[model samples]
Structure formats: C-alpha cells, structure tokens
Target: MLTKKLNRFNTLRNQILTVFLFVMTVVLLFVGVTTFHVVSTLLKNNAEEQIEQTVTQANGRLEALYKQLDGLTNQITTNMYVQQMLLKEVNGDYLGFRERQNLQQLVNSFQTYSDGIQSFELYTSNYKRVFPLDEIDLVNRLGIHWVKQAEEAKGKMVWIGRDPKSPHFFVVLRQIRLMDRWFSPGGYLLVRINPEYFQFTDFITSKTKKQGYMLVADRDLTPIFSNFVGDSKEILHAQQRTVQQNGEEYIVVKQTSPLTGWVLMIVTPVSALTDGVAILKNTILFSGAIGFLIFFIFSLFLSTMVTQPILKLTKAMQRGKDGELRPSPPISSTVEINELNDTYNALVENINHLIQVVYEKELVRSRAELKALQAQINPHFLFNTLDALYWSLVEKEEEELAQVVLNMSELFRYTVSNSKQDEWVTLYEEIEHIRRYMEIMKLRWGDRLLWNIVIPASCFDIRIPKLLIQPLVENAVLHGIGNKTDLGIVWVTVEDCHESSDIVIKVADDGYGMDEQTKEKVNELLNNKEVSSAKGSGMALVNVNKRLQLYYGEERKLVIHSELGQGTVVLLKIPKSGEE
Candidate 1:
C-alpha cells in the first residue's frame, strides 16, 4: 500500500513538492557545473591583466630611461662650443696645443650631464680626443661593428645592447654631422653607460614579483637581461605565448615600447594562475545546496497560505464574470493580492466612465479632422484664380508682372500641397519650392534682398519633411533682413555631414541681429513643446521645429546661433535614412 501511494499522483502537496524538488535539483547541478568554469575564466582573465600590467609598467620605465639618454646625446651634440670644434676638424684643420687643451676641458664638462657616463670619446677624420683619456675606448675598442652601425645611421644615435666586457653597462654611438649638416660627416661620438642610474626593475608591482619574471629585449628581440631562473631564450623565441617545458606549462605576455622599439615580456607558470579557484568554486557549490534546502522548506510553508487568498479572489471574480460585476473583497495577507484587489476595484469603478470618455475623445478627434479638411479647402481653385491673374497681366503686356504672378502661383501650389497631408519630399523639391518663394520676396525687396543656394546635387535625392527649409528662408527674409535698408545676403547651404551620418542645412543672414533678450525668447519658443499653433511666420517656425522632432526625435530640434550685430545662423540636421 505504501509503494502504491508513492507511485500514485494524488495530493497537490505530493505533486508540488516532487516537481519543485526535481527543478531545484537540476538548477543546483547546473549552477555547480557552470560556477567552476566561470571562476576559472575569471581567474585566467585576472592573471592576464596582472601580467600585462607588470610588463607595461616595467617597459614604460625602460623607455623613459632610453629617452633621457637620447636627450643627453642631443644636449652634447648641439652644444655651440662642440659645433665650432667639429667644424674646425671637418675642414681638415689641425687643432693647436691651446685648442686641444680647451677641447679636453669642454669634453670633461659633459660628465656633469649624466653620472652614468663611463667614458666619453670623440673621433674625427683628422684626429681623436677623449675626456678621460686613461679609460680604454669601449666603442671602437670592441671592433668597428658598432662604428659601422653609427656611420650607417648618418647623424642619428645608434643604440647597441650591452658591453660584452662589462654586461652591466651599455653603449651609444653617433656619427656627428658637420655643424648639424647631414651631408658633412665630421666625426663620431661614443658614450659608454652604467645603467645603474636609469635601468629600473622595481616598477613592476610587488604582488606579481613572485608569480612571474620580466625581460626587456631590443628590436631584434635579443634579451638584454632577465631574472628567469631557467634559460630565457627558449621562451623568448617560442612561436606561441603558451609554452611547455620540463613537463610544466607557462604563460607569456608581451608589449612593445613605441619609444625604444623594444619588446617587454612576462613569463609565469600556469599553476600560479589557477591556485585558489578550485577551492573557492567547491566551497560555493557545497554551501549552495544547504541554502536551497532551507529556502525550499520556507517556500512550502508559504505555499499553504497562498491558496486561501487565491480562492477568495477567484470566487469574487467568478461572481463578476457571471454579470455581477463589482469590487473584490480587500486582501492584506500579501502585497500582491492586496494590490490586485485594489486594481480590480478601481477598474470596476472606472469602466463606465472610461467608455464615456473614450467616446467623447473620438467625437472631438473627428471634429478636429473635419476642421482640418475644411481649412485645406481646394488647391486647384486657388491655382486657377492665380492662373487667371497671370494671364490678365500678360494680356496687358506686363511681362515682369506676369512672371512674378506665375512664380507666386507655383509657390502657393507647393504650399497648399503640404495641406494634402504629404509628409516627405525630395530635398530637390524642397529647394525648388523655396526658390519660388525667395523669387517673390526678392522681386518685392529688389536689390535690398539677395539670396544664394549651395547644395550638392547628390543630396537632392534625399527625402526630408515637406517645407523644412522654407520657414527658415522666410524668417531670414521677413524677420531678419526685411526691415534693414542695407543689402542683406541670405545663404542657404546643405552639406552632407559624413562623420555624423547626417545633413546639415545652414540659413544665415547678415542683418541687424536680435538683442540677447529677444534671441533668448525666440530660442525658448522654438524648444517649447507646449506652444499652441498660431498664425504668421512665427507659427511656421514652430511647426517646422515640431515636425523635425516628430519625424526624428527630440534631439533633432532646430539650433539657432545668433548675436547682436553678427546676424543669425539657423542650423538644422537631418539624419541619414537608417538613422531615423
């Protein structure tokens, strides 16, 4: 009988607990398996970051030292006194006894530039001079291999790695030009360095000091020096950063210095990276089961209380569903049920009122649409009337008057077409439409009003909201320069802003500009969304601003730049096709 009961699916308690247990077990297993992988990935990333940071820090210091050494070379080479001596030698003139004494003292003074100067020697085609002549020449002293490098570099400094005699020191060689002329090879200046003052290894963070070791290599990747316990050449020349030697895995990270063209690398064992991850991941998965068990017990206890409130709410909803629509009884046991009851009560109270309100809104919307249609009237009727006026003037032999009337007819024809609810027009159509409007304005103002349109023909195919630029042109004519007697120029330019993937249209007029207060007011009016529709050119400005925002977004609003006497420039940007 116990086995039959266990096999049977009967009570909600048994069914719920069994399904919940299966789900929680699957979830816990998934969390445990994935947690180990996630922790491993995180540790690897942190290790790579640590090693890379160490290499960068150490390389940065080394590059700084090299730059300082380069600076010292510049200081001694460009010294005016040095230039005079080099020129004298390049001219094949022998130095007098007094001049040679002066040259030695001048070379002796260079020791003050850096304390790392192990030896300073200058070689000329005519003769040779050394600061401390007792010290053997390390530059040419170790064969002419370094001298050839310096000679090949012309006048630039050539950096050779370490001195084979004393590995702790390095050498720099340069073939000095005659008075800074590259064509004239005057002499060679060689300086041996003791890097104790500049070569710094402590820049690497102390935390990583034990995990890995760093090495600085020249452009050819020859290792200058390293702290590796084993051979450094095997790891340095490996094709891949991850290497295995003596049955152990190691990871390498490298960064090349731009200043010195040297490679900085860090090498560490793979074991050090995954040191604590296994223990931490195991601890997390172990504690997770205990925590979930406690949660399961509490959830079962809470499940018993949930059904009562649900049953009460169900009965209330059942009565409403049967045409007794009314408020549900109040519930305070859970915030969810309490809020559900409050929402249902509010819906019951507001349903009839909402229906009536929607009906009224529809009625108002229909009336508005009807008024808009009536206001549009018919464009053809107006067009016919303007046609009659144009012909009447033509019959009287008034050619210019007839032409002005014809342009006016075309301008109004385009403006009235906008009332037909057309939203998009090719930019070419927009510019052409404004051409007629400006012609009419110009014919009225004569020489006082002049205009120019500069738009790439390529941009003519782009579609924009109808009449976008007309209002700006109209504002420039009627508001900006309409009252000024002096000749005012209105420039309309459209540029394809490739960087931003937008088109910028500028309408600028050099007229008596607005005062600070009025300009502020006009700007506020353009940005104010609550503005009511009004008549005249001002409303036209607002409508254009509103349409730009509606078609694009809030960021597409018109930008106005103006000052007291510099006039005003209105800038508007239209995003490319997909940008909208």
Candidate 2:
C-alpha cells in the first residue's frame, strides 16, 4: 500500500508536476546543503583555533613551571650548606644533628616557591633516594634506567615517562652537578609531576570539551595521557591529522612544549563540529516539501489549462465527423486554441456551402433535362398525330380518324398525367403505350411504316422509368422508315437476360440506314461521346441514353449497329431492378 501511494504515474499532470518538483527540489537541496556545509565548516575552523589557543596557553603555564623548578634545583645544588650535606651523605659520613637541621630548613624554603610538584628530592651517587617512591623499582630495574638517562644528560633536565607502576604521570630527572667542577655530578634530582598538576584539562570549557578530546604525548610521539578512544601508541602515531579510529573522524593539531618536550595535541572529532547542522537539515527538508506541494498544485492547474482546450477541439472534430457540419460555439481559451476552433468552424461551414450549391445544382439540372426531353416529345408527337388525323379527315375516313383520336388521347393522358410524379410504370404498360404509338404512325405511313414488337411474359411486371422506351420506337418510325420509299418495317425486340439479370431491348428498322459518316455522328451523340456538346440527328436517342444512365447508373450503354444498305438496330441494355 505504501509503495503504490509513492508511485508516480505518466499522466500529463503528473509529468508536468514531476518535472517542476524535480527542478525545484534540486535547486533547494543544493542551496540548503551548501549553506549547512559552509556554516558547519566555519564552526569547525573556529573551534580548531580555540583548541590551539588552549593548548598554547597550557604549554605556557607548563614552561613557567619548568623555569620555577629549574631555579629551585639550581638553588638547592648551589647552596654551600646543602652541597656539604649531599657530599657528606654520598661519602657515607654520618650527618651531624645541626647539619641535618640546616638541610631540612633549606628544603622547606624551596617548597614555598613551587606549586603542584609531587616531589622535590635529591638522590646520592650511592643510590640513596630522598623523593617519594612509587615502590622501589629494584626488582623491575625502572629506577636504574631513569638514573642512567639522567646521568647521560650530564647537567641538563630529562623529562621521562612510561613507568608501568605509575598512573598518568611523568618524571623530570636532572643530574646534580658539583659547584667546583662543572661536568662532575654529585647525584641526581627527581621530580615526579602529575599530568593534572597544572590542571591543563581545565583549559577546555564544558562546551568545547563536548566538541573534541585532548592528548599529551612525549617527545618521541609516545602518548603519556589521552582521553581519545585508542591505544596510547595509536593516538601518538596519528599525529599528522585526519585519523579514523573506532569509526570516528578527528582533526589532530599538535604543539610541542619546549621545556617539557610533550606533544600537546587537540583531537577534534569532525562529526561533533557539524552537530549544529541537524536543525538546519530538518528546516530545509520541511520547507522544501511545502514548496514542492505548492508547485505540484500549480503544475496541475497549468496542465488542465493547456489540455482542456485541446479536448474541446477534439470533441468539435468528432461532431463534424458525425455529420453535424455546423460551426462550433464560442470557447474561452488561449489564442492558439481559439484559432484552431475558428479554422475548424470555417472548414465545416465551407463544406455545408458546397453541399448546398453543388449537389442542389446537380439535382435541379437533372430534373430540368428530364422535363425538357418530355416536353420535346409531347409537342412533336402531337403535331405529327394531328397531321396524320388531318390527312385521314381529308380522305373522309371517319372511323380511322376517330380511332386515331382515341389512341392519341390515351397516349397523351399516359404521358402527361400528374397523378404519378415519379414516372414509374411496369414493362407491360410501357409496351402497350409503344403499341398504340406505332399504330398511329402506321396509319400515317400506311404500308411504309409496318411495325412488330417482341416482349416476353416474364418481363411484363418489371418497373421502369416512364417514357423510357417510346422515343426509341418513334425514332425508328420517322428516321429509318420515313427515309425509305418502299415498304419499311420497325422491329421492337425485348428479351429478359436471365444470366445478367437484365432486360435487353432493341428497336430496329428494315429501311435504308444512313451513310457511314452520318451513322458515326448519330452514334457519337447517342453514346454521349462528346459529353453535352453534340447537336444533330440522334437527339431522340441521346435523350433516351441519358435517361437510361441517369435512372439506372452510367453502365447502361445504348449500343447501335448500323449498315449503309441494311437497317439500324438500337440495342438498349437495362437492369432488371425496380425503379420508382
């Protein structure tokens, strides 16, 4: 559960917020850590300087004590009465009562000028000791070793340490020289000085003591006394600096006391120096978290501000695809989003305008062409029928004229009726209308316009557009039969193409057909080879051809086969599908 809550997703808002928070966190951490480090470093340096001062002051006090002790030793060695007593003791002569009393008075006088001196006594050349003894080292030979080192110094002081029997202390040995002979030693003086005698640890205050530790080492880098957690030799050997012992880091600074020859080293732990920065770390982390939260919220707002407009534009595009080609409503957003909306609205409006202008224009044009063709057929047929009736009346044939009038009335009613606006009629009805049309033309041309029609029973109920066939029959009667002088025959053949699921109709004439050039021109116009530019003989066939293609689709082609002396057949292939 905690892991899931800590996980960040790849949503736009999250991405934006993450980037902003990352940059902000980096900058804040950089600044905060840098400030903490710099302050911690400054504190360390200041503490180091203070520690060095304390060690220097401690060394000065020790140097003063050394001078005082040296003066006291000079006084005791140079005194005429004290030297006589020491000579009497070294020669094994018994000391007189008055002489011992004078020597004790001299020792009391030396003790009055010195402080923190555990002992101040002289030892004779015969190994007779006068100072305090930590137990006689006759079995260990340590006392003999100190005496031998003191004799080697001749007249100088030798500060010595490493007495296994002693507790945190050292000895100062000086060979007692004779007054008469400068290099001749009468005996040696011993001073066992406690490290706490001068109270050097008191130099470190309570606050600074918590910061680090202090150590005192001998001239050969051997630690005599140390508060550091390491072996005496380990502390002394790490004199240069930067020692890691017990997983704790320390900075070592050393100052050697000239008189005492002790290395006073301040071992300041590095971790202790930066202890004050913990508060700073907590403060920076708290403030950074608050800042990151605020930035994340701001990023979310910004992400929504950018994405909402795009979502709206996407919805508008979806509406356009759904056929709602209308302009979008006003939107309040950035400039780019507003521009995109405006452009999209404009595109939809342009599409709607094109639909209105182009598609409606095409519909109006098709209707006009159909009506014009119908009008042309009606008037031409009426004039020709009237002329044929006039000729019958001139011959005084009442019955034939009356019969022609009735047929023409029925044909006009079929073609011009306003009851059916869609002009749909079954194939049987269309064939009957063609029969009546041919009968009137046969009356007008007599034997020159004989006609025959072949229509199948199965094709009788198939519906087709009205007046789609009459014009072809009329064209064969007037052009092919009227142009010949002998008896002409018009053949109308209709067959159901079962395999192709279509109805094939042919209107042929046995009269003389046109020349090769004329036939080519007529067929070109009928086939619509020149689009809407052809003008001449096959206008009626062209009218039927266009209506066929417009009602049934463009694949319906009006095929024509003609020969100069043989006759012409116009083959119309129409689909068997219903039309209304």
Candidate 3:
C-alpha cells in the first residue's frame, strides 16, 4: 500500500504539478525582491534629483536679480548726461543747475524699482558732490567705504558688502567712464537694494513642505537669506553631500550664482523623502503573498490539464503490451493534447486492419508457392520421361529423332536443375546448354540455320548464371534465323582475359532483322522490372535480361542492335567474378 501510494505521488501529473509550483514560487519571490529594490531605489533617486533641480532653479532666479541690479548700476554710471557733466574741466566745482536737473530726472525714472532697489546714489569726482543733495545730511555725506570699493571696481560693477550702520543693506557700485577714454572714470554710481525683496518662498512648494528648505549665502559663507537657520560652513559651501544633524539624516545640494558669487543650498531630510516607501514595501509584500497563492492554484490547474491526457495515453499504451491497443479517453485541453488522444484512439483500429491485410497476403503467397512447386515437379517428370524416350529411339536405330529427344531432355534438365538452386556455373556449362539448344534449332532448319561458337578458351571457365546463353540462342533462332529465307549465320563470341574482370559476349545473326517498332518493344520487355513473369515466346530475351541484372546488376545486362533487312546483334557483358 505504501509503495502504491508512492507510485501515485510519482505519476507524471503529480510530478509536473510539483515542479510547476516550485518554479513559480521561485520566480515570484525573485520578482518581488527585485521589484522592491528597484522601486525603492527609483523613489530615492527621484527625490534627490527633484531637490537638486529646485535649488538650481532658485539659483538662476537669484542670478537674474543680481543681473538686474548690475544693469541699473551700469545705466546710471553710463548716462551721457552724467558722463559729460563729470568730464567738465572744472578742478573743484558743482554741476550746473541744468545738469543737476537732468541727473535728477534719470534717478527719478528708476523710482519704480522700489521693490528691490532702496535708492540710487551718484558721487561726482570733480566736485566730490553726491546726487540727491537735498536728502543727504552734512554728517553722513560721502560714504567713504563705498567710494573706495567703487574706485576699486574701475569701470566694472561690483557687489559692495553690508554696511555696519545698516545691517540689511546690499549695494552695487560702478565707476562712471569718460566718453572717449575707457580707463578715465568721470565719477561713480552706487545702488542700494533690500535683501528682503528676494522671494525664498518660491523655491519651497506645498508638496515639499517640511521635507526640505533652502539657503542663499555669499562667497564668504555668510547667509544672505535662509528658510532653515544654520551656520554650518559645509552646508554653505558643499555642492552635494550627506550630513547628520540633530540625529537626522539630510541630503544637501548647492548651486552657485555666477553674477553675485553666492551659493544656493537645499537641505532635505532623508526620512521625509523615503517615508512613503515603507507603505509601498508593505503593499508589495502583501501583493506578492497573494500573487503566490493565486499562482499556486493556477499551476495546479495548468499541470493537471496538461498531464491528465498524457497519463491516460500512457495507461492505454501499457495495456497494449499483450498485442492489444486500447483507445485513450478524449481530453479537452490544448490542441496537441487532443491530437494525442485522437491519435491513440485510431491506433488500435489501424493496427487490426494492417494485421488482417498481412494475413490475407501471406495466405495468397503460400498458395502461389504450392502451385509453383507442383509446376516444377511436372517439368522434372517430363524431362525424365523424354530422356527415357530418347534411349528407346536410339535402341530403334532412329538417330535423328533420338538426337532431337536427347537435346530437348538436356535443355529441360538444365532449366529444372537451375530453377531449384538459381545457382551459378562455369561459362563452359552454359555454353554446353546453348550448344544443345542450337543443335535442336539446326536440325529444324537444316544448313540454312548456320551457327558458330567463337568463345575464347580463357572464358570457358568464367562463372556465370546457368542457362544464361540458351535463352539468347533460342531468341536468335526464332527471330533471326527462323524467319530468314537464305542461309543465316548465328555467331556466339566471348572475349575474356586475366588482365580484366569483365567478360563480353556477342551473338550476331545474319537474318531478317527487326523493324524500329519491334526493336523498341523487345527492348522495353528486357528493361521492364516485371519481365520475370512475362508471357509469350518473346519472354526469352526478357528472362535472360532480368537474370543477368539480378545477378550482375543493371550494368552487366543484355544490349541489342537490330535493323530492317540488316541483321541483329545482341551484346551481353558479364563480370568474370559473376554476381558478388
């Protein structure tokens, strides 16, 4: 019972289901783990990239603000009115009233920039006079620190650092140049901008709220503006880095403004970026478990559907061991499984039909063999009886009749003896049989059927099929000499030597030869495969041709040449070694 149970477990269906389940489990587990790792890595990378891009965009905006301030400063310093006024030859002088009014109008035109620019100041070098003289106090007149920085800038714009008196102050300074000479500065222009005018809130979106913050700092690593307060030198200067602060991990990304020499830094918390990944991980785990359960059931169903038909076919084949074929039950599954079922169902019927056909054929073959044996016996008896009659005719002194009986009996004996063995004999034995047949033919036609045998002595011992030459001789007498009115010569010639393995034999007759149609018909009979059982007196050539081919193959067979009123030549090629 235990062995039987184990065998049942080992059946093809059970084994297939087991393997399918095992493979599916392995594949699903692999997919789950790979998917988790890939999605987690993807989410983290996307978060880092988004943070970096935000910082870079904020940096670009800050750079644009700096460019705008620089443009304003350039415009004031390069104004033709201001340039020509500063270039006047006065050693120590004040601008004329009209020049002062023109400069004031230029300053007033820029009043709309009050959002970022606090004020514009112009200091002329010739008189050391400042623009907006009405608003300047006597005590705070020149701003010597800014003036020195503006002198250092020459004709270029420069960012002036915060003034100690005004902590929130940002200034851009530039030297005014003369009309014709670039290096000769006419005066200076200074523009003050409020740092609070920059919108840091633009970099922080609601989706990223509490996830990260940004900072803008100067080249000196001092903060110009910051949403998250920090004084760390690394955060201000580092390009991209990871840092731990207050027991929390953060990713820092930074971008530099080319116009202001300031750095834009983004500080992002690692947990805030990856906090949603934990839920994703749990969801994926649940989905994987559920997927495995579904796959297990699917594999069982698939394996059962695939293997059930095969098992049924196998059982039917096993029952066929006793020479019985049983039809397997039909299965409804894939096309190939159904095909197998149909094939097995038809197998028994085909096998039984074949058996019946083979039995009937064997029965017919047996009867044919019996009739053939009986026929062979009749020929043997006839030959023996004719031999006895030949002796009796010799005793009565009838030499001609006795010679005819002897020749006929000899031909019959040779044919019957060889029919039993289908044996090979020496060319000399075949020649003797042909001579006897020719003698009988000569007696029938007298001298008109003249014959010659010119075979070489060397060829006499060559082995050949028995009675191979007699049929050709009979064909010659009947078709060639028998129908001729004048004296006809039938010549049999053979060429053989020790130097060659092939023996050539030719039979030529000078008699009434065949016409084209007759020649073709005779050739067809010789070439036909069924010539062995061919009927009629013309079968002599066909039988000889068939026997030669059977023994020496098709190449060593009879060839005939005949023509009307010209004579006939039959050529036969035989191997010296006969059929191998």
Candidate 4:
C-alpha cells in the first residue's frame, strides 16, 4: 500500500512539471516577439529622424560654400588690375610684345591678390595672347585654341572647356568689349580657377571622422571635387544614367547660378548620416534578447508554482468529457491564476459568437474587393469590342474598313496597357497612338475631318505618361468635330517652352465650340466639382482632367480657351521630361 501511494505522488509531480515548462515556454515566446518588434520599429524611426537632421546640416554647409564661391568670383571680376586690362584699347588688332608684357603684369598682380587662381590669359579676336609672360609659342606648340570660343561668346562670360593649360583647372572666359562702341572688338579675360578651391574636404574634414563624404558634381554629373581621390568617371556616369541608384540612398541639393552656368551638386551619403541609428538598433536588439532569456528562465520557476492546481483541474475537465462533472481542485497559490481560469471558461462558452463576428467581417471585405474588380471591367469590354469590329471588317473583305478597325484596335491596346505603374513612355509612342486614332477617324468620316500633327524631332524621346495625349484627341473627335457640318480642322503641335521649363502641347480645333454656359460647366468638372443636372454628358473630359491632376498637380492641368465661333484650343502644360 505504501509503495502504491509513493508511485501516484511521483506521477502527479511529473504531470505538474510538464505543464509548468509548456506554459513558461509560451509566455517567454510572446514576450520575446513583442519586445523585438516594438524595439526594431523604434530604432528604425529614430535612425531616419537622425538622418534627416544630418542632411539638413550638410545642406547648410554646402549653401555656405556656394555663397563663398560667388563672393570670390565677384571679387575677381571687380579687381583693379582686371578693370585696367578691360579698359586697354586693342583696336581689333594684335598687341605688340611690349603691350603683352604690360597685360601679363596686370594678370600677375590680380593673381597675387587670390591664391585660388592657377593662371590667367588674355586673348583678342585678331590675336591669341597669354598672361604672366607670353606663352603664345608654347600655346601654339600644344595646339590650344581658345581664341575662337572667346569670339563666339562675344562679351559674355563663358566656361570655354576644361583647361588645356592645366588639366586640374577650369577656364572662365570673360570677353571685354570697348565702352565707346560696344561693337568694337575687345580682348578676352581668361581666369583659371583651381579645382581644389571647390573641394568640400577643406570645410567638411570634421564631419568625415563621423562617417560622411561630401562631393560636388557639374550639371553633366562630372565629378568636380570629391572627398576621396581616384577616377570618379564611372560613378559620375552612373549618376547621370539614372535619377536615383540602388543600394545607395543620397540627398542631392543643387544650387544653379544664372551668372555662371554652373550647377553645384551637394551629395550626402545616407550611411554616414544614419550610422548612430544603426548602432542604436543593434544595441536594442541585443538588450531585448537578453531580457527575453532572463524572462524565460524566471517564468519557468513561476510556472512550477502555478501549474500544480491547474493540472488537477485539467484532468478533472478531461474526466467531465466522459460525462462526469467532478469539482475542480481547492486552494491555489495566487488569485491571478484563479481569475485566468474563470476567463478561459467564459471564453469557451462564447467561442461561437467570436467566430461568427470574424466570418462576417471577412465576408464584407471580400465583397468590397469583388466590387472593385467589377468596376475595372469597362476597359476590357471596350478592347473586346474593337477586336470584334476588326475581325468583322476582315471577314467582309473590306480593306479600308479593316484598316480603320485595326487602327482603332491598336489605339485601345495602347490605352489599356497599364501593366507598369510608373512607366514613362517616349513622346514617339504618344505620337504613334495619335496617328492611329487619326487614321481611324479619317476612315470613319472620309474627307470631312482634316487633321494636322506638327511635332518636332527634338521632342520625340522626351518621357511622358502612356496615353496622356490620345485621350484629349479622342475627346476632340467625339465631341468637337463629330457634329460639325463643314470640313473640320484639328491642329496638334508640340513645342518647348524654355522660359516655363516645360513642354507645351496645343490641340486646336476649328469646329463648333461651346458657349459661355457650356464652357463654365466644363471648367467646373475640371476643378473636380459636380456639374448641374441641366449640363450634358462630360464624363470623358472629367476623367481626363482627373488623371492629369493625379499624375501631375493642379498647376499642370489643361487650360482651355474658346469662343462660340472661334473654336477651341486646349493647352497642356506638363513638366519637362526627366524632372524629379
């Protein structure tokens, strides 16, 4: 009898121990996952915030550098010796050897005032000259010809090219015109600036110790100065090839000088700016893991105390499954476990209610997604209609009819090709779609519809959104010229608006145009306002307007100008291609 009692006691203890280990493992796992996720998110956000702050500091430093350079250029332009050289009379003729020596003395005096200047040269339209000693023979020996460019530039300041005298310098040529005639031929003032003057290392040396690099690139993405020395040609090429790069996140601040034609680029590496945040993330992860391990060990000890009474109750519940409602065990270690037991029983009673709620929510979400998919069916329907029309014309042995159908089919294909979300199509693709649309219209209306598309070759490769222009053209045919009695003329033109920094597309039609009331209705729709019930169908125009506003902003919306008898002209002011 004693041995049997001992065996039952040991069996009960082993069951309690197993339940304790299982509960502790579950609690520790939940804590670990929750801690890790919360800490990781916080670390990432802090890192990004820190990086933004560093970028702001770097931008400030670069702006200061730009200001300093501008001041330096102004100083050189106003130097007394430079002014004296500008005042000298050349009479459109070559300077004597003695006169060249005097000009060299002036250049040397100006060079003494600024250490950044590597060299200076003077050249006239009639004769090429060098300063600080006549090096015309040497210039001829080296085959350096900058005199032609000075004449081409006339009286304006121009960056001729990379310096032939010294590869490390960039030559700035300021043509000096005579004050009396202004047309009288004058000499050129050539100033060579050392590349090291713009190098960021002189000011950003302290930041480099904290993991930062500053670099300056020209408008062509040619590296003018860099913190590290080597051939940066490949990096410069990569920067020019794409607006952004993979595996490298950088912030580029550009300062363009109208006076100098120089595009100063300030580049800050993201890694240097966010290194502190990376360290913080690693620290948090390490500490959280250590905390989880300690909590796991502590929970194991605590579970041993809590699971004894629960094990007894669990076994009683198992017995109840066989139709015996035995009472639970008496006397637990803590009130929390007793409360947990009560909660679990309540949850079991209402499990069906929770399941019903989850199922209903999921069903509602699925129905919403189905409705969204249903709304996208119109484009597919239109494409199918065009395909059917094409095949029907082909079967009837009508060549012109078949060609028109095919063109319409191609137009719809281009419109529905939305596989790429951020795809930038060439201007040529846009023109091709317009051509297909016009061909279809010509076949439908015969000689009644007249169209002229004038697009320059320079605008062909510019990137625009796919199907951007065709929609307006379609609207013109469907609404503007569809009801016109006499021959209708539609003119489409693409031109560069350099002053506005954009490409202007003008679509003008000499057909029956809208009155003031109808024009106001169209304007309301373009502004995303609801039209009055009396106003007619404007769905296509509204859709086009919304899409343009979505892709670009309100500033890039379509501008309409029209009169009752003067017809209508639609002007689209889209940003130039390759802009950020």
For this target, which candidate reaches the highest TM-score against the unseen true structure?
2
lDDT of 1 by residue, 1-580 (tens): 9888767746455556667777787887788778878888898888888777777777777777788877887777777777778788777676666775777677768778777688767766433653444435434455568777877888788888776666777777777776655557777677788756554456554747447767777888877667767768887787798988888898988888887788877888888788867687768777777867876896576655665676677787788778676777787678987887788788877864555445543453454457556655775787898899999999999998888899988776666553334557788989998888888887889989889999997798888877789988988888889878889999999998877778899999998778888877777778776534467646656767866765676678888888888888988888767225
How well is each residue in 16-98 modelled by candidate 3, as lDDT tens digits? Answer: 77888788778877988898889888988888787777777778878877777777677767777667667672334667777
- List where candidate 3 sits over 4 angstroms from the true fold: 1-213, 218-222, 229-234, 237-375, 378-410, 418-421, 440-450, 461-463, 483-488, 497-502, 512-537, 546-559, 562-567, 575-577
Better of 2 and 3 by lDDT: 3
TM-score of each: 0.43, 0.51, 0.46, 0.41
* Highest-lDDT candidate: 1
Q: Ten residues in a row with the worst lDDT in model 3? A: 134-143
lDDT of each: 0.75, 0.72, 0.74, 0.63
* Candidate with the larger TM-score of 2 and 3: 2
Put down candidate 4 lDDT per residue, 1-580, tens digits, no spaces.
Answer: 9999877767544555556556656665676667656765665456445444544555565556555544554454455554445445454344556766875775566667555677766655344564545447423522345555555766555554467657778766665665554555555566777876565554444544444445556555655666633334544444442234456655433444444434444345556545665666676668667866676566556655666767766876786577555455444567876776665566544554444445543453354346445544787787788788878888898878888878877776665454444346888888898999899888878899999999888788888876667777877887788878888888889988767778889888887788999899888877753322232456556655654654565455788888897788888877776333
Our tally of clashes for model 4 stands at: 0
Indicate the worst ten consecutive residues by lDDT in candidate 2. Answer: 132-141
Ranking by TM-score: 2, 3, 1, 4
**Using lDDT as the measure, what is the rank order of every candidate, best first?**
1, 3, 2, 4
State the lDDT at 535 in candidate 4.
29
TM-score of 1: 0.43
